[model samples]
Target: MEQAAKELFETVEEYFQTREFKQFFHFVDAAIYLAQQIADVAKEIHLLLNKAVAYYQLGDSEVAVKTIRKLQPFERHMTASQRIRYLNTVAAIYHTLDDTAHYYEYLMQAYALATDMNEEIALLFLEGNLGHYYYEMKEYAKSFMHMERCLMYCERLNFEAHEPYIIGRVQYINTSLELGKMAIAEAQFERLEQFPHILTNHHYVLAKGHYYCICGDKQRAYELLAQVIRHDGQHETILSTLYERFLHVAEEVETLEQYVETLETYYHYLGRLKEAQAKKQIDQMKIYLNTELLEEMLWHDPLTKVKNRRYLDEKMPIWLDEQHSFVGLLLFDADHFKQINDCFGHRVGDEVICLMAERARQFFSSESAVVIRYGGDEFVVFYSVKQLEGIEVMLAQFHAHMQQCAFTVKGEVHHVSISIGATVVRANVPIEVLLEEADRALYQSKQQGRNRYTQFQQHA
Candidate 1:
């Protein structure tokens, strides 16, 4: 009888040490079954928790829930701190299930228990979890405060090793900024930027952009907004709001008011005229993204694109209008190009135009240049020249460069040249009128001599 008892103890010890549950047959085998008959429910509960964690990692949330439920009888046997921890794990499972109500309730219970037991780490995680729930519910004030405390706890506890906890600081800063709590938001936002891993994170950059927006620095806001747009141009709801807000604030500055007016005027001409239209576009964009009305809006130009127009409208306003000085626009015209369509096939003519457009793009100095087909054979080179006198000289160099390239059609080489109308923009000039003036100058170049560059005149 003693030998049989000794054999049972050795088998149970091996079962616990080996995680024999990895095999269904072993877990359900005669050995564990015999041990289960002998041992209390608490030891079973402990083993079940470990199994549940493994199942949760495998995306088997249902099974994890079942395991947790099966362990409920063991809760009475656990100590105070262990019970709190057990509840927190259950809360986390609810999170994976997206049962937000259960998640919050269990988290709150764990937080209460942890507070009662004086377990600081458990309370910190619980407070942060509850704050996330509140933030999702749009209860900004309390959410912001609790999250602020979570950030402080992470800081005080030296939790730099955990990235998500640090990111909670940025998340709260964004929530506060949205709520218009600028003073506290600014401090939180600055801390958020200093979070050691800000460079690569979307949330970090967005927090910084919102900081600039909230601080009423429209120039920096636009700049950062441009960066965000470049990195992820598809998130139009965010990009549109940032652009509109930047434009709104820029309009308020007396120094920028003239150029800002021009910027809106250009957008109006581009069919984004009214505040109602802008708002409608945003709403449509939201619906298109949400309801599959459009799957890939970013790739198609808002106006005309086999390519996206967002790339143009987001950046060119500031580039051509000169929020910063020393940028140039070279308006290019297809030489007697309209006559070609009237004489030759429009298909042949379109092929020629596309070839000419490709040639013009090859002359760019940086990623700063945007070549919009602007409608037909008329194209615009909206670019910034980093070096002085570089903007004007670029056209001459482009013309010289174009003189050498040949296009092949049906294996036949075709030569094409374009008239260039260039303009330098100052912050004082409105971008719409400036571009219009450049187009007029472009016409003058075509009349006097095709394949030549002309600078636009400033109206008094």
Candidate 2:
């Protein structure tokens, strides 16, 4: 079989050199078969490039990426700019892998290589990726910078068929919203409907719905939101948009009690909680943040900057409003914080707290999760594991990143481990109730060992 396959590869190579390639009516089957048999990735790449060029002329990038991979590289065959475009595609796959930091690293490399190669097209993709990454990371300045860069370059490249316009539009809306420019966000979102090739166009609708609802256009808000949900039949992205809109709505409107009611009704009618988790977390966080506008500040832990008892009290009220979300809280404390302070002094102790908090913060890289200071030496982390599942995978990758961050104190290097208690907040409970629930989980962590996670159970 090996000898037969080798003979086949040799025949295919000879066929590729024939005049058939020069003919307008090239035999695709012969060319394709020859391309597939190339041994070296580089030669494979040449074969793939021929196919890619063909696929591209056919206007099928999705197929191009897939077919291109089956072929190997051709040394110096493609321009440097072309190679950078290939790298950009590789970076995109990493982005889809859902590790923000790794995604950022690969994208940055692509951008640098593209710039060095003078590939404007590749740079445009890099800029667009950076826009979404920074937005997800909650770094507004970076997001805005990259988004504008993407738009400018895309226009220069005349990428009307690409997603440049739409990605820019969505990035603009998110950047404006984060910066508290609701009006700008609305306008940006309005532009998104007309923008071409946006993967997240439905999100624009939800953003408008949530913005109007929060701005007191209750009728328009509810109607828009309903439209958003209705569009779910046509688009799957609707679920994430609905979940985001619901969270923002929970913070702004009172009738979201009805919003929750409607969603709950649908969930039962549909019989699935898989999509409802994000809505649940948003509802609970809203309750905690809105707990008596004035007293809401009381529950937060100052040192760790997590929700304190006061925060928990406020959050408790809306915990079960959605019949599902009630996000789990990881309440963590540093064991023997006093020992570190006593050995290194108060200054060192403060530094340790900051360091630990910083690491805990990394757990929320995508900004979908909330990490807060519950009180002195106590921190709370609430993860909305809906739009993003696979928490364990995230944690595993996080471990690798953490190894690179060395915390130094008092002319010495000291690493601190935290005890985390994780538990789901029962539905309809207040933030305070959730905290208590999480606290019990925290105790279990301490009992089992100081430096780990323990889940709160039913009735625990």
Candidate 3:
């Protein structure tokens, strides 16, 4: 199954080369199906990521983001390269969404991770992505710097055959043109022509058209650009450039009808572009609402209204992988909860659980920690903190609050107390190890008499 997916991905790459996005999307779907049938998470991540890329390339930014979000739950299964690609793709999608902050944030994350891993191939592509980002931002100097680095990596890695290398060279020429380095642009364009595939690539043709327009060769520019407009008219970006180019070349044309036809086509594409933009906004809003609804239904505890154990399981791997400076894990439960249920009836026991959950939520808040119902009568708090003293103080305040709170059962005043076991550590460790540490401390709390907090101490 994995082999079948791999073969389909290779075909998908060919479809991409031919600019047959619909065919590319179909092959990606086939690969995803194969990956799913085998429960191959790594392959599935790779294929789904490509699917998102196809969506983005086809100008469906909202669906691209929706597809990418579906992979978050499986992120822990991603390989290092896959993770970098995920971040890069996410950054690109955010760029299309006009979210400049997240665009830079995730791009830098991909760069940082690739650098840390010494993944030269990922770095090469990331350099090109950064270059392209700066180019779009009209920061030509910065774009040139990254593009230079990207080309250097391309040479060093012998990656000249790949799309990144080709695109990087194209962007290099575009940046040079923007910076008024006409000589550099000419030299790079000459080098770009050596790639036989560039002859058929609309991007290269568009660049050449722009070059000819700048050089005052209106006839040559019109011919090359006309080809691009004919082949790639569906894309807003391509049409946007063609609109301006055709306007510039309109005066040199033999007949006004030629320019008018191009104008009509551009207006048609603009209308479609606007319609797509509006639909994208609506789709994005729907995705946001559905995401919120899904999380509330899937992650929240029904009775207590806090997060549930499933939520903890989903989040634990992500938190652990982050390798925070200080992590504080706290496990607590209502003392003699079974006895309260047995003696006071399940109804009163239910009230006690609800009251404890309410206090936990109040004390912790969303800012301080993630409070979860690990099981019946058992609650857990995961905290990222600078100091253990802060946790101790919070626990003290939480216990004090519990003491002051009382409820009436059968017209009798009754107080519920909780025993807590906590461990604060500074290293990356498995969740089970942390749980075991907290459990040992909890055992001590129970042994020393309930209604107290115990901190685990690691002996030297």
Candidate 2 yields a Cα-based lDDT of 0.59
Tens-digit lDDT string for candidate 2 (1-460)? 4465455545545544442322311333333333333323343454455545444443345555676565333435655655665555555655554556666776787788887777786777788788888888899988888887887887787874465666566676767777787777766665565655332356566556656655778667766666556655443334654655654554455475766776665555343444455565464344323444324346544344345555444563443354465355667777777887788776457556666666777657534455666666777766654522454455445444433433465467777766766666444556666678779877886888676666667432
**Taking the tens digit of each residue's C-alpha lDDT, what string does model 3 give over 1-460?**
5576668768876876676765665456556655554446787787788778877876688889999998998788889999999999999999988999999999999999999999998899889989988998899999999999999999999988877888889999999998999999999988888888687576677678788877888888877767666666656545466557666776576488876776777678889888877886675445433565467668988667688889888877686677567777888888888999999777567667767877877776586578888888888888777765577787687778766545686579988878889888764767787788999998899999999999898422
RMSD (CA, Å), each prediction: 30.1, 24.8, 18.4
Error of 1 at 398 (Å): 98
Lowest-lDDT window of 10 residues in candidate 1?
299-308
TM-score of each prediction: 0.40, 0.42, 0.49
Candidate 1 segments whose C-alpha is farther than 4 A from its true place: 1-47, 57-59, 209-460
Candidate 1 or 2, higher lDDT? 1
Model 3: clashing residue pairs? none
When sorted by TM-score, best at the front, the candidate numbers are 3, 2, 1
RMSD of 3: 18.4
lDDT of each: 0.64, 0.59, 0.79
Q: Which candidate has the top score in TM-score?
A: 3
Write down the lDDT that model 3 would get: 0.79
lDDT: the better of candidates 1 and 3: 3
Q: Where does model 3 exceed 4 Å of error? A: 1-51, 54-59, 73-78, 227-240, 251-258, 265-460
lDDT of 1 by residue, 276-394 (tens): 45775464335223433253345333222222345456656655555465556667766877766786567457566655565766777447676776667667777665665565566
